[model samples]
Target: MTGKSQIADRIAARGASRSAAAAAVDAVLGEITSALAAGERVTLTGFGTFEAAGRAARTARNPRTGEALEVSATTVARFHPGATLRARVAGGSGEPLGAVPDLGSLQGLTASEPTPVETPVPAATSSVKAKSPGGATGKAAAAAKAKAKAKKADVKKRADAAKKADAKKRADAKKAQKKADAKKSSSKSKGKGKKK
Candidate 1:
């Protein structure tokens, strides 16, 4: 298992665990950090570039005093991980070293490596149809009447519910405002008595 050391350590380990591995990792990370701190960029093959970028100075207001203050320019280190790293992170082939095979075109392949065939099932046909009382017109008229009745019932139910909810809300708000006014008047009377 690879420990939490730098890339240098992993490379130095060479499939063997030793103190030299940690030292190598530390040295490489220290060098990279030093370069970045000094405003230098580092590039790794198949990996992205690392560099220190300068942030522009800006004027910011102090929240406490509402006074404008100048913020000084600063440099921040940033890492752009390489394509191979990104692909690996994103659970891809990470094939920057070689071209990846076209798996999309080879889709639907089985483990036995046999070509699959598409078979269509015939649509079902029903011999007995529903018998209406009179004809299609009678059935449609009956459906329309039922639909209009349902709509009217639903509208009435909804209107009643909304009216009830609005009344309850208004009552609650009035009660809350009355309680607040009473509290405020009580506090004011106490303050006046203390003054006297």
Candidate 2:
């Protein structure tokens, strides 16, 4: 995965020391994380915008058990890729993107408020409901919860197995020690009798 280390390596290759490059990456990420935690947004020019959005409480179905459950409202971080970034990923040649938003305009925009765009919808899917762009839906939260529970159970099972293996190892080591001691004592006793 192209993580912080990989980015730092690239930066270091460009002339900055490795430590300095790593520090720069850490500082950037740290600032973004803290800003999001404080209910703010961090916009990287020509990269993307990161912000926290509120998710409304709703009823969701559990994917594993197929049971209906109520999920509480929570805020989740969301990212909207900038036009430049999107273009870099998706090859150009389509309609050119609009003018990039100025930093002043971006700063004035709140995390919860996204710029509105009007799109013409065909009649085929007009009656169907579409997911809200504000934040994650109930189904997404439920799926995340299910995955987390599975991971926790797997970790616990592995930990219990590890404990049992350690206990057995210790017991076997003790038995071997006792057998060695008994053999040494018997050999010493026979040696003393022979000398007498």
Candidate 3:
């Protein structure tokens, strides 16, 4: 339910001018949009990642008209929330919602009032550890740890595959260049040795 204006207001209440807060919000959104448009992923450690995802073309039907149509393949913006944001939404922080002070009161308060302290959200990695304590003895904890380990391993595997592919590409380019150079040298030698 929170919109950009609400976010801007929150930042403005935190001693920043309304214009500055608005500008900051706009700059962040602009950068995220630009990155997504450029097919790059933007990851905000404890917030989320924004990326462009490909959707394959497919046939679809209209429910009301029973008409068939073709959908074109395209890239769409996608967001995957990081653990801290997900945990906060799931009420895993153990802190009551009421504990978060009302920002409305701060609007009218004088400068003499203490500035609200913003509690830092735990990092996504720390959040996972918080969910699965070291001394815990349960199948759920063990499963969670195994799943996390598997996910980490999968990421590493993908990175290694990409690195290998890049190296292969470089090697192929070098091989092509060497072949072309040898061909040019042979052609020159043949012309030099010809009587005509």
Candidate 4:
């Protein structure tokens, strides 16, 4: 949660006035932002590199309604941390870096071992029957078979309806095209008659 103000405070601790430190921090950050906006990479030796990366257009889905959507391609800002910063964050035995302060706030930041939890296993019961390839016997299987048949019939009906609709649309289009051609031909004959 270390922000720009905290960074300026850290800088001010090294003898500079608070306003001067804030201005310096603001100037540096503004330059970095400007460079990135102009598609230039800004690299701070032991900190990170900032640049604009192009993203390709893609199709995405709406999670709520399961509807598909298209996402347009664009350029986005990206950051890549330098080796020293990576090593420090990973608790490597490297020399201390100057940008990041050795504060108590960062203490105990090392990864801790996860505690193991005991899960109870369910007791087996003899009353539950194992299923065969044909499934449960009697009424349940009959009901399942009937439901499956009904679902298949409904799917077939919808498919047939869609096919009929497509056929009708094509037929209408063909008829309209024929009428246009006939009209064009009639106009051409009328033009010849007028010339005579």
Top candidate when judged by lDDT against the true structure: 3
- Measured against the true structure, the TM-scores of the candidates, in listed sequence, are 0.38, 0.46, 0.47, 0.47
User: How many Å off is the CA of 30 in candidate 2?
Assistant: 0.4
**Which number leads on TM-score?**
3
lDDT of 2: 0.67
lDDT tens per residue, model 4, 48-73:
89989999999999999989999999
> Which residue window of length 10 is worst by lDDT in model 1?
125-134
Candidate 2 lDDT tens digits, 1-196 = 2345545555554555556655666656767878888999889889899999999999999999999999999999999999888977798543324333432322332323322322234553343332332123334545668999999999999999999999999999999999999999999999999999
Tens digits of per-residue lDDT, candidate 1, 1-196, equal: 1122322233332432334444444445667777787788999877789999999999999999999999999998899999878878799652233322442322332224321222222232122111331222344455668999999999999999999999999999999999999999999999999999
Residue 100 CA error for candidate 3 (Å)?
15
CA-RMSD of model 1: 26.3
Task: Please state every model's RMSD to the true fold in angstroms.
Answer: 26.3, 19.5, 19.9, 24.3
Worst 10 residues of 4 by lDDT: 125-134
Better of 1 and 2 by TM-score: 2
lDDT of each: 0.60, 0.67, 0.68, 0.66
User: Candidate 4 regions off by >4 Å?
Assistant: 92-196
Clash pairs detected, candidate 1 = 9-25, 47-82, 48-81, 48-82
